[model samples]
Target chain A: MTRLEIDHLYVPVAGRTILHDIGFTAEGGSLIGLVGPNGAGKSTLAKTIAGLLQPASGTIAVNGVALDTMDRRDAARKIAYLSQGDTVHWPLAVRATVTLGRAPHSGRFGTASPGDRRAVEAALHRADVLSLADRNIQQLSGGERARVLLARALAVEAPILIADEPVGALDPRHALNIIGLLREEAARGALVIAVLHDLALASRFCDRLLVMRDGRLAADGPPHDVLSPAGMEQHYAVAAHHGTHEAERFVIPWRTLNAADRKPNQEGETA
Target chain B: MNRLPAPATSRIGTAPLCLILLGILAGLMLASLTIGYVHIPPGRLVQAAFGMADPATTTIVQQLRMPRMILAALVGASLGGAGAVLQGLLHNPLAEPGTLGITGAASLGAVVALYFGLAATVPMSLPLCAMSGAAIATVILLVVARDSASTLTLILVGTGIGGIAIALTSLAMNLSPNPWAVSEIAMWLLGSVKDRTFSEVWLALPFVIVGLAALLAAAPSLDLLSLGEDTARSMGLNASRLRTMAIAGTSLAVGAGVAVSGSVGFVGLMMPHLVRPLVGQVPSRTVLPSIIGGGALVLASDIVVRLIAIGPELQLGVLTSLLGTPFFLYLVLHLRRQLP
Candidate 1:
């Protein structure tokens, strides 16, 4: 298990800063959800923390080791990142694709070990892609392909798993299933950070929620605290309806907030 | 007893297949040496190889056929390995030197070297110029193909660059000083393994070996790269670094090949397809087999060149093109369904 620590992390693309002084600490054994609108820098924060994008002005540490100082393979052994996209370059078999997740653990020759095969099988079962292991990835449907990719990440078995919008555009059932799988992964003592747009799913599965607005962590707390009516109105620009079902909290976005609902500044009330 | 558990990804039994291909390649090389119109028997050929035969037979087997066969093997293996590397490195199956116009650059470079009267003065300068051309074109390709260039963009850019280089080579051929030189240029441009001397092989082997080594070193990284650049990066790979290594390796292999053979087409593009089904699509495992399969294909083509002899005989490049065009079309048609 590993703990991910980010202090005043900044990511700048071109000249403008995309992530500004973002700070967060995610310990192992939790499914943490980062929720925000488009362009809210959730992906940036995740990529930066995963070492895909180098943080411009702050430090990210994996297992108390500074990420910048770590080797690429070492950093990879600690963190597994699944970026949200449609990507399967070759028509590789599903099992072969999942085996790529063991790249960091394997030697430079990519020779497979007994442990690597075991991890791949376990990941295939956990992601529910074992049935499709022999099939070509290109032949699988979008949902199945996504599951295979998820299986690939799970095969990494890294202590810290950061997935950027893993369930975006997935059907409700598959989306819920993916989140549930992440929850299970957290139970295995992996620090699973998933970026999600669905507030209800985020509220349902995430042990803690990190809300982002304009490159900043607008709010961070339990789903109940971060998905509150005012919290949704302030950071998400949506008015949410809070509900309880089966001893768990679920938040629903009723409507987009109009100008009338915008909180007035203390200095001046133009409206 | 030594055994591994079930494979982590690939199917079993690729080793025997690789050995079979190696056996085929060896048999073909001997057949290439023995089955020529010269008609040296296998026993005499072996005797000649070991310095136990008459001087005349030794000269025919050793001095003449041996170097040409070795050169063909080197060129073929280089194309095969380089082709596999390019496909995995760029994650584009259609990425091969002949298709991507690197061959045109190499041809243009060799022609330019010859046109400057440098080949007559310095034999090594020809391949050096070719290497320079390949390296320059690769640099241009990298600059033109930003990391995010789409497949269409890569194809279109490759076509555009290739067209310009071919046209320039034609222009150089037209402005030649004599008809004899023009004819030589035309025959060379058609791409043949005929009349290949040992000296040319010596000139190219070092660079081609280096190129093969570069591609082999990057094989493992390419397996990870097959899963998109972002995912590859997340696995602690620097995509740009891998990109540089792959291109450099290509320049070395294809540059030396085009330097000697004058732009033999499609061996690099075609070898991986032949080897993939047997070895699975894992980049690292496929590389050596691709090299072996490439050597087999080119060696067979050289034999065919000798078999169908009228007077001047068919060039090796012409045969590869004749066979490769249909394969290219088949792949493109399949690619049409696969691409969005």
Candidate 2:
């Protein structure tokens, strides 16, 4: 029942346009992966959708109401965002850190209600950090801290969850663990938008993919269609190996595109 | 009524810690009343406290000792609370009024007022000017380092601002019209609660109360900020509003303290760190305890000044600076070890 619609969105930072004419419509019950190379405005787009950045133009409507007019608390209650490499400044207890996600619903004074407590507990459980709840957040390993931060985001219980590079800089096992958690959240009916660098994981796990290049949306469709070899070379400048594992399509970037790899007809146009 | 799980490392509950600190503060206040120059016996101290004793004893207790004690507590509490709030807001353990150059800016402002002879004519101008200076410093720090605010940038910029303010204060003294003005300004800069009357006490009380309340109110939002700014905002925190409140509160509280007692450095910096271990590092929980701990510290320090009976009565600011400089160095060394 949750719908997020963006139309003709333009985001400018320091007079430089970072997101150009971006528009998309997403709803609950699906996992969407935002894929692009560095400086492709993937993070910018995620931030705009999460209401962290102000779009210079266009409308962002949530469930038919324009986001511009929505109360800050109401918007917060609907959208949970986890920034890339999010850090805890203090060595706060893990449970205390997760409990902060209840701020939007905990009223002005931040008095915790029973529902807030329940939500925090459930989020801790969902993110598989329940055992570390009593430990100090700063003392945790990077992977453990990632789960704790994810738990903080999940504690919001929002319909739309936006995570920018949620699994970056983690071991392969921890990365898979976080991706699995994101999938579970989507399966539970939240619209999860994750900015991912792993093409194989995106292709296998994401229901849909939105590809970005030079601050523009290059392609949008099912990952199978959007992550084609031609699209991969054109957008990400990567020559990828494509195959199917157990009937599910996957993509692996084999090597960076060089001038010799391009066909004669495409050679003169661009790299 | 609190349900948040206590930190596993926490030795005592926050509530009990606060109560114990409060008890200690109360006991210290009582002891302070009895141990002054007159040495009113504990039995007579109670009578004087309620205004039932002879007029002279009553005057000594109510007019002299009471205002001094209350002012110390208020100033100390504001300094401590401001430090906790700033540290949380900036996500920097080194952020405090002293380290951030706020107290120096406030001192410069008061010194300016004294230099121009405005304080003698218009007493309100002193705190007003001091608060204005502090607000300007806070705004400058925010604007100049708005982007990353790395430790290097914050500390360097703060040192620059503080250095400039202190140098300017010295310049004002050098250009003073007479020896009396220089001596008066110099003595005030040493900082003490000596001879403070109810007028000075009343002047600082409202600002301290309001500032402390603002900091306390903003404490919970600070907890959100620990997750970083973008995440905190997504969690419905108004980061800009929080910044405004923290700046205004620090300015008012630190300014008022400086106006009455010159610049009592390092109370803000030390109190939070001292109390942080007891209640855990959660910013909100750290705040109340830091404030109460600050009150206790200044009260005890003021009593120590009286007990030591050093030459010229040992200015409170000088002692704290003497103590604080070493603590600040230790903290810097500690941070270096931790980071690398």
Candidate 3:
């Protein structure tokens, strides 16, 4: 029954506004995709929502508790955030890194309880990294590392999960598997939000879409409605073609155009 | 995959490991008392320890040897614990008190105290000035190496400051009017536990105890920081506060050790690297073991220094550097091979 709400959130970095007047709500058991072009502030928006960055002027609440009012540990218990490109300096084992996600649950002394150990094992199994549990994280392949990090986030067992490009470094098969995992989390009543670069995958996997243009929310609705050719052309300035295959809609962007071609066309005008 | 022998289940948490470390430390203290220039056999040492020995033996054992042995252990533990904290704070295994300028600053402070004829007037003045110098140098390093700087930059800055401090110390020693002062400074730089008294141990105990307590409190925070700053902050730690506490504590402990024993090397830098994997890479679990392990290493080296030389007793610092330099080179080579 947890819901994450960002109301009129405006985030600025070093005096320049990055995310402007953006708002969204992620209810439990929902999967929301945040898709945009480069420099559209998708990552910034996600970071702000995860409480990694403070908004310039806005309110972010989880389950009706304002983020500013909650202690860090309490907020962490509600929302787990996985950044885009994370690296570890220490060569910790897979099991050890996953155990760190239980920090919020563990007290100041940092001894893991039996319940914490059970959660870690469950997370490792869910991310399909149980076989490599003892492997050093540094020795893992890129896809394997990504899955390990995802497992760490899952170990938090927070009601809301925010991942910024979690599958960007994975292979095609691994990418689909991660998306499937996110959907599974959502089905289990966790609110899952992911910022993705691949529009086709986003459309196929997400239950809802949030499209951004220059730090503003350009469209928010079902993927079928918000991912139309007109919306793509308006937000990305590219020509797109949409088609139905095997009961799925696929979107393909062909090319961008010159400034002259971007003007409104007259009724009698020829190409 | 050859699994790292499952870290023995008994040593899983910080509390159990801490207790085991204390037990080992107590045993090592007793062993240190038994070994020395004159092998007062264990039975005699224990009888001497209980104040039931012959007058001559009691004077030699209780009056001279026991205090020196305890001083060596205390100095070793302080240096080792401080070194672990510094390394964790900088996120660099190479960071140690000597390399990071705290030792050099302390040496300079001691020399300055001697030049002003303060040591003869007030014995505690030397250690107090040395602690102040270490604190100042640590603060300078922290300011120069801001929160966002890389570990390499921090180490480079520390080296630069340390070099300046050493130069200043050498200058002070050379310009002193008293030849006795020059000789004293030289001996101090060589680092020894010889001729130390119980009063000197008491002078150092408070700083070391407080510094170690501060470090232990910050151990869990250091574990969080190993994941990197952003992740640490997201997990509810104030990274800057943790770093400051660690640096301050290291300075206090290292400064006091330097004041008492001169610039003892390698204990801090080597102990954590050796015991970290044994404790499952948790910084919190590593602190106590590092302290005990550090004390053991120094006391053993001191004993070896006493026994090895034919004429003059070799300095403790020289002994550690002789053993540590090759191990350090091996580590660099191993790290190079591991890096992509």
Candidate 4:
């Protein structure tokens, strides 16, 4: 079954269209990378899917249910979203913050059940922050905080996990660890969709890639096909060099030019 | 199998802490009843409590001192709970009732009510007016701040509004027609629990109860909010709705408190900060402790106020200001040091 479906999604903010005719589908247990530059509306699309922002038009569906029709709590149970930046006021313990993911399942009085506690502990373990469970979140380093946030989302145990630049602020090792964790989640039958800026990471870690340009999907396919030199030149106006390193493919943007040089770039004259 | 580690109780749980606080509150209640200028014996106070004392002593204890003590506890608790909620919502430890201007607005309302002779005609009318004023001011502040507004903007705007409200209150007090109106307004502004009767306590209780319940209900939401707005919303909690509810609930509780006790400061601002670290910064746990601590602080200050008076009683506000100003300065410096 398709775990998430976006059909003709249009999003506008402040009278400016940020996303137009954007659509995609991620089947269950798939790791999909959403790749684009700064103005590609990647975060906006993620927010719309999470129901945090209303689309200007079109529809988003999760498990064949229209997102607009479902209650926020029900949507929350099915999908968990982790944004690019988070601000925490109080210096809460890591365990305390992660336990907040079970808020939807908990009653109005917010008493965590046995199941909730187990989920929190499991998430902390999965994110490898169990040793720091009692430490204050604010006292942790940036990478540690990012892992803690991932643990918080993991505690939700939702089938669809949407993370926008989840590893943007982390070191290379921590970033790779987070990508590995997301892959593990996908292997466990969760749809893991991450909006990422690192083309090399996307090419290596993701099973499929969706390239966006100017608020529209430019290409969608396996990484080898979608990240070709020709596609990169045509859509991104940049030349990409792809090579295999340590049994993994890496894509790097090497140069940029106008449409006049597109033909030569596509013909591999630059190489 | 290894025995499951005993449920961590290094920090006291909510229920036991509540019981202990209730016990302390009960003791304070009895102490408030026993200690006075007339020095009613503890036995006599207990007898009066049980309705076994002479009518005169009974009147002095039940009708005079008992009501004032109850009002003090209620008002103190309300201020403390409101402060915790506000601080959590604003995500700034410096955010407090005084900073937000809810108390100033309430005092202005009370002064207006007094000037119009409405307080004399109806005892509850003044508190009602004060509550409405508080609600209006809070709504305006929230509307202006909106969802995306920064904490700095919220505090700056709140401080500006608070200053304006205080100015208006001073103006109203100065312009009163009755010769006693100025003194009455001055006394109300300064804050005191002296010479109060049961009638005033009854007038304020319902509002306090309703407001406190609302604040308690918002406790869990406040905890989620401390994680910040976007996180809260992504967790299926509506941040705007929670913020509105918190502000409204706080205004109602603090407004009633101000209308009755006349702008008692510091309790609302200081209680939450004093208890948050102790309770691990969880809003759910901070609520009761702040209440207990606030009550204790205010009651202790009130006792001191009574003890130090020579001819006429000094206002509780005066005592609180004298105690609180230094703490406020320390907080300002501490917050500056902690800033990035």
What DockQ does each prediction reach against the true complex? Answer: 0.47, 0.56, 0.32, 0.43
How do all the candidates rank in terms of lDDT, highest first?
2, 1, 4, 3
Clash count (model 3, backbone only): 0
- Fraction of native A-B contacts kept, per candidate: 0.62, 0.71, 0.30, 0.49
Q: Model 3: per-residue lDDT, tens digit, B1-340?
A: 1123443231356567667767777776777777676677788988898789998778877777778788788788878888788777666677778778788888788778877888779988888888888888888877876654566677677788789988898888878788887898899988988888888888888988887887777777777666666666666677777877787678777778888899888788788887777676666667778888888888888788877857898999989878777866676566655533
Task: Give the residue spans of candidate 3 off by over 4 A.
Answer: A14-17, A212-219, A224-227, A256-271, B1-24, B109-125, B136-149
- Give a tens-digit lDDT track for model 1, residues B13-130: 5688679889999999999889776799899999998878999888877777887798888888888888888777767777788888888888889899898889889988888888
Q: Poorest 10 consecutive residues of model 1 chain B by lDDT? A: B1-10
Clashing residue pairs for model 2: none
Ranking by TM-score: 2, 1, 4, 3
lDDT of 4 by residue, B85-132 (tens): 888776777677777777788888887888888999987889988888
TM-score of chain A of each: 0.95, 0.96, 0.94, 0.93
Of the candidates shown, which would achieve the greatest TM-score relative to the real structure? 2
Q: In candidate 2, how many Å is residue B27 off? A: 1.7
Best by DockQ: 2
Clashing pairs in 4: none
Question: Which of the predicted structures, 1 or 4, would earn the higher lDDT when compared with the native?
Answer: 1
The local distance difference test score of each candidate is: 0.83, 0.87, 0.80, 0.80
Tens-digit lDDT track for model 1 on A167-216?
A: 99788888878888899999989999999989999999899999887788
**Tens digits of per-residue lDDT for model 2, B229-275:** 89988988898999989998899988898889988889988988887
* Model 4, docking class: acceptable
Deviation in Å, model 4, residue A71 alpha carbon? 2.6
